[model samples]
Target: MHLPFWLTTALLFPVLLYQGKRARKHTPRLPEAQGSPCGQYGEGTPDIRFLVLGESTAAGVGASRHEQGLASQLALQLRERTGQTIAWHTFGVNGIRMGQLNQILASMELPQADVVLLSMGVNDTTGFTPRHRFRRQLLALREMLAPRYPGPICLLSVPPMHLFTALPSPLRQIMGWRARQLNRVYEQLARHAPGDFQYRSYPAITDVSLLASDGYHPSDKGYRAIAEVLACEDWFPDQPAP
Candidate 1:
């Protein structure tokens, strides 16, 4: 944890608390996208298994169906690029902190995946998780995943909370500050992790229309835009799965 930052937050506690309550009361609660959470796209012999896990966005809260969400959109992009069938799955819970997500994963029998794209940070930021604890939780999650996933683990940087027009002034800035701190933790982990671990940031969405009606999660177009960027990076291995 950053001492100075936490001290500042402590000083602003009452105001932040009030703002948080107000925001919660006013923001519309949108359900996760309704559809099968797993699917296959394209056609080929050797296929790629892609998994998306983390928070609301990973759960497809902003789209009408899983096919229009990040997992499928990303699969489509990869299919177009590699001509290989992309089998994708998503596991995400709204308002889940890193520790909770880790616990849930420990209880599940997940399929082996060629690539893991994880979306995290917002809830942790808002929950005020200590920086060192966040680091430990992330490292633990990596260890748990490495055995099941023999491929790249891409950590998507926390979306810019400051950009969420739904939030009022100081609350938006404060949350954005916390988000940056967690993002730095992710960046540092990626920098030192083994070759398979990587980090990517969502492209800045300047247009308000790109966000869902809630102004928090990304709209379908936003998810597509993000998928385009992730695919263009070409982080997947060149060799076909055995």
Candidate 2:
């Protein structure tokens, strides 16, 4: 999955510049995470506290309704799947990178979460972060939250950059390559982290219609698709959501 040195520097340079210019003028800004900051769903005792953390995708940019977003969808699905009332909270910003997330989590007070679902990587690629730095920041984020949310953390693969219709040409391929690299780092981290971490691969997106109008983020249908995959992961299928 590694790109050659020449391709990294020479081939991608000019394209990167062109893409940046196009993005500034053409990329549409989507709405932020909506709905109540914290929501309760289903019925059970000892409620399960769930946290949704990460960048735009986790923030629910493309989805028109808060209920259509990942946090709410996951909360509702978990109730249906396991019958536990979920105290769901979403902490996501549209354009934050991994390093910023690490810094933010380090300073903030997070809910005592039973399960933490994260969606990032896209912003890391957008920020042109080196692979090692991205990995370090990601792990740092997990470590920062470990003490407060001592439960399983599901780290989603960066959505497929190759599929972004908004981004043109070689830039798409380059971003796609970088996105894969980021996912590899996440996968490697999860392998060693075991019970504390689980790497969730980006689900295969079949319908282009599922993408938001911006074509960079997930549409409401897209978020539902993501929530479905997260809810059905074998790791948490029948267990207490934590």
Total clashing pairs in model 1: 0
Q: On residues 41-146, what C-alpha lDDT tens digit does candidate 2 reach at each position?
A: 9765536677889988767898876778888887887777777677678888889988888888787887767778888888788667888888777777767777
Per-candidate local distance difference test: 0.86, 0.77
Residue 138, candidate 1: Cα error in Å is: 0.9
- The local lDDT score (0 to 100) that residue 106 gets in candidate 2 is 80
TM-score of candidate 2 relative to the true fold: 0.90
Window of ten residues with lowest summed lDDT in model 1: 233-242
Best prediction by TM-score: 1
In the range 1-242, model 1's lDDT, one tens digit per residue, is: 48888888899999999999999999999999989999888766438788999999898988888888999999888888877888899989988999999999998999668788899999999999988999899888888887888665789999888877899988998998999999998898888875656898867676877788998888898889889888877656583332
User: Model 2 clash pairs?
Assistant: none
RMSD to native for every prediction? 2.5, 2.6
